[model samples]
Target: MPGRGAGRVLCVSEFVRNVRLWFAPQEIREEGGTPDYRFSLANERTFLAWLRTALALIGGGFAVDQFLPDLRWAWRAGLALALLAAGVLCALRAVNHWVRTERAMRRGEDLPVSRFPALLSLVVAVVAVAMVVVVLTGWEG
Candidate 1:
């Protein structure tokens, strides 16, 4: 009987620990007093918004790759890859920003500053300009 329930207990404990680590890591959870739940929810909403943007970018990349069969191979690949890369970066930025913002809020500090928004906008603008050139130049496959 000693080991009969040991595996179940271990699995349950591990699952609980993982959930705790993900939602309330000791470092962030233990720091400072708890902020208002409304603020935490607002931060989470912003995180979801960033993730939605990332998903849109990723979907746009796939649509370009799939729908623009007439586009030249180089142009198609370049645009799609740029979008996909931007999506990847956006997703990572989303997570990083969420964690930083949450930690700062927990510690009663000013939110962390980031230039990723400007950088991402520049990337999208450059891609749009390139697309315009491709359209004007008749770069069809």
Candidate 2:
């Protein structure tokens, strides 16, 4: 029944909602039911953990670029980019997960299933493997 313009408007509105949920805790509290302090604190701690991980990833990228021996320029750059990208992704997902968990708590609903941990594990493993290959191959430039 809606026109294309209406569909576009809906999409834009949904995006705005998601952005607010990710960044605006005060707004979320105003719109949604209030959750327990303990639960909210726990969710905040989890978000902090994710932030730490993101920082570590970014730091590790710099470390690898600075300290790793005998890496070609392109390889170094690629590795750094990969780590930094993973870090950015982790950070973006962190806010999403926090919002989702907070909303679940407010709604008195079961917590949402989380795939972030598994995804983090996979990223770490891939980085490790890549490093191992580089070290074994003695890639130098």
Candidate 3:
């Protein structure tokens, strides 16, 4: 029992450390002075917006899978999976961008550049096109 609990305790401690690092890694936090509150708030807002988009995409995936039972299995699964995958990617991008932007602002560097927006847009467009094709072709169960 002690041995089993020891591993569990170690795992929990590692998880806590990882969570703390995710939010406030020392390398980034200590590298420069604190940024203005306004900029920090803006960065947080942008991060929240990305999270909202991710949530919406995830919800849309669930809706497609649940509300469109008449859709062919392959199409429904594909659409749902695509939306879910996009949501996951968006969530990850949100964190990475937030960290990079925050670090840049703190260091008085130009904000980091990224192609995530363009890539996300392209993904959405492709999904939309697929949806239109499915609807037009009457691909239903």
- lDDT winner among the candidates? 3
Sort order, lDDT high to low:
3, 2, 1
lDDT tens per residue, model 2, 1-141: 579889999867865776777666677776557887988999999999999999999999998899875787777889989999999999987887787787878778899887779988998999999988887775633
TM-score of each: 0.79, 0.81, 0.80
lDDT of 3 by residue, 1-141 (tens): 999999999967854654565767776678689999999999999999999999999998998899877788888899999999999999977887787788789899999888889999999999989888877674533
Segments of candidate 1 deviating more than 4 angstroms = 1-24
lDDT of 1 by residue, 8-39 (tens): 89957854554454566776687788889999
| Candidate 3 or 1, higher lDDT | 3
Best by TM-score: 2
Winner by lDDT between candidate 2 and candidate 1: 2
Give me the runs in candidate 3 sitting further than 4 Å from their true place: 1-24
For residue 78, model 1's alpha carbon misses the true position, in angstroms, by 1.5
Candidate 1: global Cα-lDDT? 0.83
Task: Give the Cα-based TM-score of candidate 1 against the true structure.
Answer: 0.79
Reference-based lDDT, residue 39, model 1: 95
| lDDT measured at residue 7 in model 1 versus the true structure, 0 to 100 | 87
Worst lDDT 10-window in candidate 1: 14-23
Clash count for each candidate, listed in order shown: 0, 0, 0
